[model samples]
Target: MILAVLLIAVQVAAQDPRLDRLDPDTRAQVTAVVDSARLAGLPAEPLIQRALEGATKGAPGPRIVTAVRRLSVDLGTARAALGDGASVPELEAGVAALRAGATPQVLANLHSVRRPPLTMALSVLADLVASGVPADSAAVAVLALAPKARDADLVEFRRAVERDIALGAPPAAATSIRVNAGADVLNAAGPPPPGPALPRRP
Candidate 1:
């Protein structure tokens, strides 16, 4: 009986206390969504965090629940594109990529062209798209660099794009010019690393 009590205490303690800030009904709803996501082998913290962010922003309860539900779906979609080997940050970044207008095929193709730990590349892709670069152009630019650009290179590339846009260049034109300049040598570094690594043939 004592052991059972301790186990129950452990389980209660394991729950995130910040969730208590939510109304009981909203808390239960969000918890159900998070639990479902957890069972599906996806990260749950992001969903909880999304809920908390909504609550903090003074969003309506229904809105918070809807956002969490949508994010859960987005995470699953990202996982399918990135595969099981992807880290939580990579998956979250993939969610950002999708939200920023990148297609699932682009995400999957990124998985094929790049090695694991795709967080930086995914982040830059999302940033470019969100900054108004056309999604196809953003994906093209990112895929061009993913082969040989280091994390630092991606950061610099994003900054350069931002600068050009700030200087009145069209987003797509900026992305295209920068990619050609930065990736010319890297693209010639030999084709993508071996193996069939994605969801589609293309």
Candidate 2:
């Protein structure tokens, strides 16, 4: 009986319930803040610690609450935008942009281009997909913006588009682009012909 009691004591001690000490409304706010930090790719433990410290240091509850509330709202927006498939960096970027007040249209436009050397494209696409954009729309938009894209960008974009379509970018969108997208983009963006194929080999 003593051993069981000791074990129960240890388990109870292990559970840190600092937030539970706060009023219900304040606890909700604190949760929102911490969750927001997580969504924004920020470390929540530190933020929560900081808030706790501030509270200890005589900071007004309202101020700490407000700060946490703001952070929470920003995180909520970002997480909503990102859906369920975003990576850390993508979440960070999307959250930052959302915090900075970027619109969905702007995000859509930005998603279409693969940055130089093509290295940035895959990550960008992965993030966009996570953030609730349709795979077909995202792929098509990215390809459309490939004229100014780098070679690496094209390679990665092709890979991502294929992956998305295979996983399902919608039959209609997939068909529209697969049949003609690559050819058209290549024709437009590819280097000029070698002087009409050297006059058809005489």
Candidate 3:
């Protein structure tokens, strides 16, 4: 019976070759979490990776299992907010946003208001919160731009807000101004033009 149990555990956790590095005991526990995630249709790779990361850091087996379980729960929460059709990247971004203090309702709201492939927008929202902007204000800025802004536009807007914050503007104030002014941080001449046009070639 014990041999049968060990074989099943190995089979369940063997999805990733790298997981072979974990001790047998840790592998079995982490495998349970990864299995539950896969059964729920959630991406299992991230959970596996998290366990491997903890192992790499030389954490105890219990610690590694706890971390993997927490990530699995987070993944489930993210999927609930992003909906069934959300891609793996979107759910991953939602997890990051949640960890950064953005609420699940904020994610659900973004899902309703924004279009598909929310990976970049969620990333930006999480980055903004990490940069000290209040989560609600950051959500407002992202929601304001989500209707029409492209992914590249969101990146530029984030940079501009960070710049303003670095220059002493309050985080929320900078976010509001950027959203109202639009995400064209590289406006006028666009990214290609440095200052004036300079003379073009010889």
Candidate 4:
């Protein structure tokens, strides 16, 4: 019975289509990392997906392994920053934000103010950094807008910053100007009225 069960487990494990795309040694390494991630209560899907992405790009086994391992570490760091209650998408975005140089303290501060679906805000921060905005400046800009900016506001803000940069404004200067403009608009609107109480998550 034990041998049969082991055989069934092996068959099931072999069914992941991604595994077939890797050489035996690479497959073994990735599987081990994925299993370790699972045991750590981390989502393994991103790591798996990253491995598949590497394979699709024809990366070597060692390269794929390195990518997966790095993503695993990033995801773990994201989880630590955002806490266990964070959703998978939130964690993913957090990883991107971290990679773009958003500090852990910045993430924690954002978590304190924003509700779920922080993906958009985090992505915008990453975009700003990628577009040459200094990481600290980008974090400040995003955090300033995050308290009151809706999803549309975030999109518009990103476009404005990008446009300014394209127009030859220095990234830090452009971001600072836009962030200040946003703050002015908020201040002009007066204090926000109290809404329904959002229960704090422990």
Q: Which ten residues in a row have the lowest lDDT in candidate 3?
A: 193-202
Error of 4 at 174 (Å): 0.5
- Candidate 2 local lDDT, 1-202, one digit each (tens): 9768655544443343876655566666676666545545454554466467656766667777886666556545544544444444554555555443355444444443322222244344444454445555554555555446554544554565566667867643653464366556666777533333321110
Ranking by TM-score: 4, 1, 3, 2
lDDT of candidates 1 onward, in order: 0.86, 0.52, 0.84, 0.85
Residue 198 C-alpha lDDT in model 3:
30
Candidate maximizing lDDT? 1
Question: What are the per-residue Cα lDDT tens digits for candidate 4 across 15-113?
Answer: 677687899999999987877676566887898899899999999999999999998898888888777777788889999999999989899888887
TM-score of each: 0.85, 0.35, 0.82, 0.88
Model 4 regions lying over 4 Å from their true place: 1-15, 190-202
Give candidate 1's whole-model lDDT.
Answer: 0.86
Which one wins by lDDT: 3 or 4?
Answer: 4
TM-score of 4: 0.88
Clashes of each: 0, 3, 0, 0
Task: For candidate 3, write residues 58-98 as lDDT tens digits.
Answer: 99999999998988999899889888888889989999999
- Candidate 2 stretches greater than 4 Å from native: 1-29, 32-59, 108-202
Ranking by lDDT: 1, 4, 3, 2
RMSD, every candidate, angstroms: 5.4, 15.9, 9.8, 3.9
